[model samples]
Target: MRIGETAAAAGMTTKTLRFYEDRGLLPATDRAPNGYRDYPHETVSRLEFIRRGRTAGLTLAQIGEILAVRDIGHAPCIHVKDLLAKQLHDLDARIAELTALRATVAEFHEAAAAGDPAACDPERICSYL
Candidate 1:
């Protein structure tokens, strides 16, 4: 199929298809006489895999590694597990930070609700901010 048809079949934009090609995540099987890209029937499945990997918070480079493993006829389960572990750790850190921020915001809200104009501390910056 042509690039446009492949992209449409994959539920992605043509630009995304081109970008994946450039990143080596997807490669054209051949080129037409008019310079259009020709893709295999399995390209749709590959694109779906890439989309799923991205949805799982994998970066393009990480997805590329998974694709490389697949290309070499290896199952990517172990590598994917490792990547998910790291993503979980990063998410935990972010959750901690957000929890702290929520606590601080709640404290400030309580202080303001207590009718303390000092909570608006104009000498520095807006306390509500």
Candidate 2:
């Protein structure tokens, strides 16, 4: 298959396919005598896997790690599990931080709402901050 056919089969744009190839996510393609890329039909499956990995919130580098393991003829399930756990842990920490920030913002908003504009000190900017 050529690049266009592969991209269509994989439901991605040609540019996206090129980007994946440039990022080392896709395997190198063979060049025809005319210098056009010739991809194997199996490249479609790999493209699908890349899309699925991105949908799961995995970074390209992380997906690359899994691909590397599989390329080496090993099952990457354990490594994928660990990566998922770390992602979940990081998400939880970010949620906690965002929750705290939301609370702080809400308090500031309430203070600003209750504050009298006339009572604001001239030397300072927004007193609510």
Candidate 3:
């Protein structure tokens, strides 16, 4: 199949397919005489795998490592688990920070609703209610 057809089948853009190829995630199997990329039917599965990996918060380099393991006929479950663990830790930290920020914003909103003109402190740049 051509790049366009393969990309559509994988629910990705042709540009994304080309980017994956450049990133060494999905190298083309062959090229036509006109220089168009020729991909095998399985390319869709590969692209889907890449898409899922990215959605799971894996970077291209991380996905490339998984692909390398697959290419070498090894299971990538361990590596993927480790990566997910790290991402979860990072996400937890971000969630805590966002929760604190939300509390601060809610407090400010309450003060503004109370008609406290001092709420709009010029030093704070947003102190006025």
Residue lDDT tens for model 2, 40-92: 88899999999987886678997887677667675557766686577668668
Candidate 1 residue-wise lDDT, 10-103, digit = tens: 8999999998989999964699899888898999999999998788667898788767766867455876668657766876886798899999
1-129 per-residue lDDT for model 3 (tens digits):
998999899998999998888889986579999999999998889888988878866689877866776676745587766865766676688679889999999999997798967656566654443
> How far is each candidate from the true structure, as Cα RMSD in Å?
6.7, 7.3, 6.6
TM-score of each: 0.58, 0.59, 0.58
Please report the candidate that would top lDDT against the real structure. 2
Q: How many clashing residue pairs, candidate 1?
A: 0
Task: Give the poorly placed runs of model 3, Cα more than 4 Å off.
Answer: 74-129
Error of 3 at 119 (Å): 26
In candidate 2, stretches whose alpha carbon ends up further than 4 angstroms from where it belongs are 74-129
Name every residue pair that clashes in candidate 1: none
